[model samples]
Target: MKFQLDQPQGGNSISRHDGQHVWVNGRQHGASLLVPWRGEVQDWALARFDDLSEAHFEQILALKPELVIFGSGAKLRFARPALYRALIAARIGLETMDLGAACRTYNVLASEGRSVLAALLIEAA
Candidate 1:
């Protein structure tokens, strides 16, 4: 599926997504990546959900977003709460979903100018 903004959006918005990849503002990316509500896109360096660690969640702390959307590849998976304790302590809300749903949700929250962060994991082929 694809998402389009009726008018121009300031930051990057997910344009399309599927089982294998997600297109950010029309640019195709197959690797895990992070899309902030505002800022440059960056590689996430995660191949699967099991590869997640507390350090990974710590990296997100620097971005300072009010919310986080974690996309667990093609299937819906939940991460251990301990891995994201920093977010909880910092009062940052987190929502977990499949990759496609995360992409769609990111677009909606971002368009509304919310401080949303999307940590999407695209499975390796």
Candidate 2:
């Protein structure tokens, strides 16, 4: 689905998401990636929920977002806390949802100028 809003001056906002792909600032991305409010969009190496590991969560630490919106592919699946212990230890909040919800939530928070990061996974068809 495509989203409409008064785009933030320079921050990143999700334009559309449809399970298999996500459009950020009008650009299409087909792989898992990390989208921050205002910064470089990083490629996340995960391809499936089952491949999630501590290293995955650890990689996000470098971005230092106040909150993380984790998109667990096409469905809402919770990850083991142990996998994201590093984030917890750092006091960074993490929220999990299906990809669509994550994209919508990220857009709202980003537009409000919140320090949010979206860790979205795009699973294979």
Candidate 3:
């Protein structure tokens, strides 16, 4: 039962991932999403990196994660500070990287018992 107890709750291992989808605990998500260390997985409505707005970052505040890993689609992209001012003010940690890297790092951190959230944006294949 170790495998079953690995994750603290329903949000366990990310079973699989690809260019267009992510599977958490065997559940497939075809769009960008917010994977937290615990609790529910949220569907992040970011269609593309360029479409990211201040509102999107602000919306993340409601999740109240201690750290946020930003997955900028398949390519690596950075966000402007102005777009994430709320996160700064909240003293939340932020890390930016390509989608693949974000997903991997999120897995490690989450398993280690950290409160991390991965915000992944995937484009059409």
How far is each candidate from the true structure, as Cα RMSD in Å? 3.0, 3.0, 2.2
Give the TM-scores of the predictions, in the order they appear.
0.92, 0.94, 0.90
Model 2 lDDT tens row, 28-119 = 99999999999888899999899999999999988999999999999999999999999999999999999999999998999999999999
lDDT of 3 by residue, 7-101 (tens): 45545567678879988877999998888888888888889788999988887888898999998988888999999999999999999998888
Indicate the TM-score of model 1: 0.92
Our tally of clashes for model 3 stands at 0
Best of the candidates, lDDT: 2
lDDT of each residue in 1-125, candidate 1, tens digit only = 66865524578888888778888877898899999999888888788889999988888888999999999888899999999999999999999999989999998888889999999999887
Tell me the number of clashing residue pairs for each predicted model.
Answer: 0, 0, 0
Ranking by lDDT: 2, 1, 3
Cα error, candidate 1, residue 111 (Å): 0.5
Tell me the spans in candidate 1 whose CA falls farther than 4 Å from its real position.
Answer: 1-8
Report the error of model 1 at residue 16, Å. Answer: 0.6
Error of 2 at 52 (Å): 0.3
In order, the Cα lDDT scores of the candidates are 0.89, 0.94, 0.85
lDDT, residue 123, candidate 1: 84
Which scores better on TM-score, 1 or 2?
Answer: 2
